[model samples]
Target: MAIYKLDTGWRADYSYYDSFGKRKKKSKRGFKTKRQASEWLTEVIKDINKIKNPYYDWNFVDYFDMNMELKINSGIKSETVNAWQAVRNYIVVKYFSNIKISELTREKYQHFLNEYSIGHTANTVKKRHQILNSVIQQAFHDGIISIDPTYNVRITGTKESKDASEKFLEADELMNLIEHFSQEERLSGNSSLSSFMIVLIAYSGMRAGEALALTKNDINLDHQTISITKTKGRDGINTTPKTKNSVRTIKMPSDFFEIYKLFISHKSEWNKNYELFDGRKIATNPNRTLERYEQKNNFNNIVSIHGLRHSHASYLLSKGINIAYISKRLGHANISITQSIYVHLLNEQAITEEQKTIEMLNGIK
Candidate 1:
């Protein structure tokens, strides 16, 4: 028997027997008028009676996979898809595959974090929690869940910003790396291309993948400028630059131009069987080449191939390039990123200016 109550307001409670013949009670909230209560009761009863859910009825996994595939098909970058997949994999493997979206609770999430992310940085755990919360939100939007289950969850750990531990290569380090590239006696036979790749990555402020994804067509030997058509971003699309400003071309210095030409010529002559680096025509993996080069060269440092990109930004800031220009050149989605990472550099300039002003005041006083 179902119960009806008008204790606070008119309301109807419905009960039904589940598959195991266990009685389940359901109620509706916010039905003030009796007519509204009656309508809501009828709808709720129909819904409760119609649902025949099987065990392990999670569709979010399939939905997420489909959404990721759609993005990849639409020309998003692989790294973006990889990050999302990482989030999904963690949820499935750590939380169990059968965990339903509706069953997610703050306590369970807290427990998961405590167990799996022990000794990991707060930032890492926060990112994982954020991803899971994002999936739950999507489920809500899709009507597969009633509410976002991960809401109001506390993140106990804090993480530094992306550039927290980052420091630019000193001038000596930069020169050493350059000299290392030039020393043929010290290099393995394959070091020449690897050297060029690293130097170009550092000098041009191009992402490693973007540098690797470059086509011969993107490089203008005569004009000494490079066009960056695509880059890897958080969302993983391979379309235009991260921002509209990032889509602009940058001219190389004369010295760089000469080396550029020499490398281009060497690449052209050395490997006639070597195909041009066209994404559409020659779809080789840049990471494979980078890995082999790293293994062969034994270039160990505080950075990776991607670190060259960071080095470029830091070097540009050190040389007094406006943040806006650096931001555009590096394809940063916003000037805020450029400023945030390079804030110390900007502060140093300001301090110098302040010191100069103080000196001038002393002289006058």
Candidate 2:
């Protein structure tokens, strides 16, 4: 091990041989003191030794905890790690608390999944299976198990899928909801940040987190564009968006800027660096507020705040917008993702186009 002092801070570098007798080097920098650097290097060496001699007779739960620690150290996103932890706590641990990793078999795994699917939705069951399968595959790679038990396992869930109406509002309904929020903001004298947020989501189709993380600098009133550069993760504001495609700028409707101008006019002076919405104020279950609006208004269909994004996409589809353009506007990683999510709306559009094609062919004669 070697510790060197730089102009900014101290750095620690170490080299060791792994279990396969291959030499590997590790280095870390930006420590305030040489002592801190030395201590970090020592911890890294200890962790390497522990990995080289992991407990051979560990149960599934025990191994899962260890794997999560390794993943956290390897810099996995906190939100993703938290989701994996949830699956482990709520599903995997309940099913395999006493099962040894090596003793797990295809039959036992399938039985566990079958029981988990008893009352759960298909999407829920699939998510649990995906998380657990990843863990099991990692164990196989580490030689903890000779074969992956989840290789050909079947997943089954009994619950029916949610109706599309429940997932998104119709175009007219969405417009009504937007108008309702706009009127509420007008009546409340622009004191309702949540109201503004709802309208913004309806207009721009940004994720709730992405909208929450927005700042004055992200919006260009002159250009009528909003740049999506970051998101609100579990650990407050993250500097990266959910995906690479989510970093694009979207053109907002001309009317949206009018609403934005009114929304900003009511606020007192604030730094451009500060988030537009107070993070603490809107973080406490904005969905409940949306539900209240739905109940108060006589709308037959209601959706969550995320449903606003869906509603935006559905409204665009209704206006005969191209799916590829919609995909980029929504910042989807690929067009296929947009296609899958809005497949129902796309099917409706397809039927409409087919009829128009038939009418045009008949008119040609």
C-alpha RMSD (angstroms) for model 2? 14.7
Q: Candidate 2: worst 10 consecutive residues by lDDT?
A: 183-192
Error of 1 at 309 (Å): 1.8
lDDT of 2 by residue, 1-365 (tens): 89999998999998877899999999999999888998998778657755874744678898888877887788776577778889878976798998988678898999998898898888888888887887788888876665689988888888977877578887788888788777634524533677888888999999888888888889998889999998876666465777899998999989888788777777775655667776532344557778887878766777888888999999899999889999998889999999999888888889999999999999995
Off by over 4 Å in 1: 1-56, 59-63, 66-75, 156-165, 183-188, 232-239, 268-301
Q: Estimate every model's Cα lDDT from 0 to 1.
A: 0.62, 0.82
For 126-224, candidate 1 gives per-residue lDDT tens digits of 877765666667666755555456767666544343553354565566666655554443233444456566667767877665665565667787888
- At residue 317, give the lDDT of candidate 2: 90
TM-scores of all candidate predictions against the true structure: 0.71, 0.80
Against the true structure, candidate 1 has what lDDT?
0.62
Query: Model 2, residue 124: what's the lDDT?
Result: 85
Pick the lDDT winner. Answer: 2
